[model samples]
Target: MQETAYAKINLALHVRSRREDGYHELETLFAFVDRGDTLLAKRAEQDQLQVVGEFGGALDDPFGNIVMQALGSLPRPDGLAITLEKSLPVAAGLGGGSADAGALFRLVERAQGLPDDWRQRAAKLGADVPACVESVTCVGRGTGTDLEPIDSDLTGTPVLLVNPRVPLATGPVFKAWDDKDRGPMPEGTAREIAEAGRNDLRDPAISQCPVIAEVLAALGKSEAWKVEMSGSGATCFALFNDVEARDAAARAMPSDWWQMAGLLR
Candidate 1:
C-alpha cells in the first residue's frame, strides 16, 4: 500500500499566550498540499524503513525516525516494511516528520483499524500528528492538537512552497516569540481566516532566519493572492488563483532555493 504524506502549511498561526507548561497556547489554520513525501509499505517479518529522496540524507538514523516511533505506538501484529520518499525539507516548517508518521497511521488504519484512543496516540507522537493524520484544512487550538475541521474555501487552490534550504528548529523559534496574547482567531471561512489572521511567529522566525524575508519578498513579487511564512522560519508559501500563476511564481524562485507547486488538499 502507498500513501502520500501531504505537506503541511500553517495558513495563519496566532500564538495566544505562553503556557505554564512550556508549550504556547496556539490558534492556527492548518492546510495540506497535494504533493509531498510518499510512503510504500508491505507486510514483513519485522518493521523496517528505508529513506530515499532529495532530503532523505537529512534523516540519517532510521531507528530514531518518528516513523518508527509511530509504529511502536500502535499494535501491529504483523510487521511492515516501509520505504519513505523524503521530498520535503527537514525542519523547514513543513511538518515532514509528523506527516510521515501520519502517513504510517493512515496505512495502518487502512490495513487494520485505529484504536479508540487513536487521537491520544497521535497526540503523543506530536501536537501536529493528529491534524496531519486527517490531512485537511482545519482550525487547531491548544498547541495545535485540538482540531475543528472547517469547510475550507482554499481547497484545490494552487499554492507554491519555497524554502531557502535552511533548517530552522521549532524550539528556538517559539523561544524567540514575544509572548503576548494576540487575541482570538477571526471567525470566517478558511480563506477569510487566513487573510484576516496573521502568523505571530513571522517576526520571531524572521529574526532567526533573515533569508525568510527574502523568500517572502520574492513570493510577494508574484501575482499571488496571499504570501506568508509557514509554521516557523525558512519555508514560506504563496496562494494563487490559478495553476499558471502558481507555476509562474515557482519558476521565478531563485535557482538555489527549493520549491514545490501543488494544490491545497
Candidate 2:
C-alpha cells in the first residue's frame, strides 16, 4: 500500500498555557499541504525501512525509526518493508516525523484491526501524530492532541512555501516563547481559514533561527494576501488568491531558499 505523508502546516498557532508536565497548551489551525513526503509499504520476510529523497539522510538511525515503533505497537506484527520519500525538510516544524508515523499507524490498522485506543496510541507517538492521522483541517489544542475537525476549503488558494535551509527544533522554540498573548482562534468561512490567524511561535522561532526572519521578510514584501511562518520557524509561506500570482512570486523568491508553489491542498 502507498500513502502520501502530506506536510502539516500551522495556519495559526497560539501558545495558550504551559502545564506542570512541561507540555504547552495551544490553539492552532492545522492544514495538510500537497507538498510532502510519501510512504510505500509491502509485506516482506522481515521488517525494514529504506529512506530516500532530499532529506533522507537526515535521520541518524533508520531501523530504529518511529515507523518501526509504530509497528511494534501493533499486535503480532508481520514483516513489512517500507520506503520513505523524505521530501519535506526534517525538524523544520513541518511535522514530517509525525506524518510518517501516522501513515504507518493507518497502514497497520487497515491491515490488522485498529486498536481500540487509537487516539491514545497516536498521541503516544507524538503530540502531532493524532492531528496528522486526521489529515485535514482541525483546531488543535492541549499540546496539539485535542483535535476538533472543522470545515475548511482553500480550493484555489495559492501558496508559496519558502524554507531557508535551516532546521528549527521545536524544543527551543517553545522555550523561547514568552507564553503571553495566547490569543483567540480565527473565525471565518472555509475559504478564509486564516483571516484571523496568528502564530505565537513565529517570533520565538525566528529568535531561535534568525534566518527565518529573513524568509518572512522576503515573503512579506511579495504583495501576497498574507504571509506568515507555518509552524515554528524556517518554512514561511505567502498566500495568494490565485496560482498565477503565486507562481510569479515563487519565481521572484531567492534561489538559495527552498521554494515550492501550489494551491492549498
Best by TM-score: 1
lDDT of 1 by residue, 1-265 (tens): 9999999999999999988999999999999999999999999999999999999999999999999999999997999999999999999999999999999999999999999899999999999999999999999999999999899888999999999999999999999998888788899999999888888999999999999999999999999989999998679999999999998888899999999999999
Quote each prediction's TM-score: 0.99, 0.94
lDDT of 2: 0.81
Poorest 10 consecutive residues by lDDT, candidate 1 = 178-187
Q: For each candidate in the order shown, give its overall lDDT on alpha carbons.
A: 0.94, 0.81
Candidate 2 residue lDDT tens string, 32-76: 777678889999887889999988889759767787777666664
Clashing pairs in 1: none
TM-score of model 1 (CA atoms) = 0.99
